[model samples]
Target: AIALSSIAWQSGMLIGPAMAGPLYAIRPDLPYIVSACLYALAGLAMLTVGPVPRTIMDRGKGPIAQIIDGMAYVGQNKLVLGVITLDLFAVFLAGSTALLPVFARDILKVGEQGLSLLASSPAAGAALVAFVFSFRPIRTNVGNKMLVSVLLFGLVTVIFGFSRILVVSMACLFVAGAADMFSVYVRQSLIQLNTPDDKRGRVSAVSLLTVSASNELGDAFSGMLAWLIGPVAAVVAGGGGAILITALWSRLFPQIGAARSFDPAEEEA
Candidate 1:
């Protein structure tokens, strides 16, 4: 499994840029076609991966126990709930991603290449950061790092909302992506490291639900805000809300600051 996962990631990392060149040469829609192809390739690679775990009988805990433990853990852990809430807010305000196509056409008045750059720059920043993190090992003061990252993310969002220049907007989006990636890494690491083995699957399921909820709910929120006020105002307000939430979270969860390690056994079940 590990070897296959490594191979798949390395293959994507090596081959992903080739798609970008062709995508730029053709049309804006070609990127999606390229992405679909990459996804198909990834699925094929997964076939060579290790055996899949049995969900019904082989696992240590029954489905009911896992579900109950997961729910109970979530209900008791204020820190995890807090992280999830902040993630929700950040995702909600940052639905600016969905509006990038509109901005490329109407706001920046850029070409197909410009639109592709706008879409891909954020991912590039995140990919670079992920590469760095793999080597350096983010070990100390994770909570502090997370808070700083999210704050920067919100600030960059506001900056992107206000910028008229294409370069400036792209820069802001790049920074926002970098910040968001760091924050997400820390949050996911904390959650997974803190979750009990018996409840990992259920906890992961809840995280999945949170992701879908945030994306769909964020779309609705951004759309309504844009309609009632304006796109700029909606984006600015969302960024401001993100900053405020981060501040409040830091004040309320001070212990998270010194949390150097995550141990699920330490949690009260």
Candidate 2:
């Protein structure tokens, strides 16, 4: 089910650019206008959401207390904490997406169409991976696979940073996307399956902060680094930092690195 959702997400990313590029050519504002309408439609559709199942949660506590409870829950769970922090730092350091414009206009010299292609390349890779995982999910050495995926994501970012040719850069970005999706698959599965039903919503809210950090905060960090040094240096250093973080995390959370399967018994061991 998770894999299916991931596939859908990646597919949307693939389709969005193809449509946006042509729409952008016709009129720069067309894409934005269409996006706003779609968002409105989505908001309207949210009214149909069904009721949540009942759980043994303490309803008497206020929102702040519940949020704190969620935080404490995440802190106590090494598996969850390790997964979230790993993705947060690794993606923040990579920040490769933040530099797409610089690469398109200056580095790769591919122009507008090339920018769209570059943007879509990773989504293509991610969709392919998600499709495969839907059929044959990761069963054993789940932790190691996730760790390896992050490592590959960083390695590919480094390679992409040095790439001069458009095709090579696209290929590298594709691999990086695949690596990121793999880690996302594992991380989300751990969070969903391991967390209690009642705590899922609050836990998700907390996790969203890290996701923003990896995306928005990462962009700020990337842009600043690029201004300070250069695009290539910024990208290269970010990738290196992601790699280093992965190594340190593996050592710091031995149990996470040593995990064999997603079995509850094994996790409790």
Candidate 3:
């Protein structure tokens, strides 16, 4: 199902821009109009979906107390905390998508079409890896593999930052995306498998919040850093920070580094 969703997403990444570029060329506002329509259609489609069944938990308290309980549980679970923390810092430091326009216009000089290609490159790489993983998932040293993947992602981002050539930049972004895909899959599996069933919703909520913070705050960080010391330096420094965070996390969360599999029983034992 994940792979299927990835395919659908990447197909849009691949096809959406190809279509949008021409529309953008004709009318810059046309793409936004089309997107709004698509969003409306999506909302309508969701209205037809069946209701989801959820497991209710008795917390014996109000919302605030329940939230506190969830936060406490996450804080106590070293592995879950570690995975979330690693992703939070790594993504926060390495996010450069927000500055792609600068690269497209100033550095790469690819213009609108090039920007579209640059934007889609990562999704394309992720889609390919997702397809491969669907058939042959990572089954050993899942934790270590995730760490290595993030390390590579940081390195690739550095390469992309320094690259002046369009092909090289696109390639770096592609490889970075592939590495990120593995890290995301591993982190999610570890968290979901290790978290208690009753606390899963809360843990998942925390995960979503972390993801949002990473992306939104990372974008702000990138823009601020770029304003302070240029886009190239900003990206390079961010990538370096990601690498540093990964090393620190490996030592701080030994359980994450030592985890061998995604199986709940193996993790528990």
- Per-model TM-score versus the true fold: 0.82, 0.95, 0.95
Cα error, residue 186 of model 3, in Å, equals 0.6
Which tens-of-lDDT digit does each residue in 1-269 have in candidate 1? 22233334433543454356556677867877878987899799989999887444336777787677787887677667667667877778766776676677777877555666677667666766666666664867787888889899888888888888999998988788778777767777777777666566777677768877887888788888878987777778888888988888888776556455545444332
Q: What is the C-alpha lDDT of each candidate?
A: 0.72, 0.90, 0.87
* Candidate maximizing lDDT: 2
Give stretches of model 2 more than 4 Å off.
Answer: none
Candidate 2 RMSD to the real structure: 1.5
* Backbone clash pairs in model 1 (N, Cα, C under 3 Å; residues 3+ apart or in different chains), count: 0
Q: List the residue pairs that clash in candidate 3.
A: none
Tell me the tens digit of each residue's lDDT in model 2 across 20-42: 87889999999999989988988
lDDT of 3 at 209: 95
After TM-score superposition, the amount by which residue 120's alpha carbon in candidate 2 deviates from its true location, in angstroms, is 1.0
The local lDDT score (0 to 100) that residue 183 gets in candidate 2 is 93
The digit string of per-residue lDDT tens for model 3 on 1-269 reads: 55566667776776676567778999999999998998899899999999898777875888888788888998999988999999999999999888899999999999998988888788878888888887888888999999999999899999999999999999998898888878878887788888888888888899889989998999999999999999999999989999999999999999887899989687668
* The 10-residue segment with the lowest total lDDT in model 3: 1-10
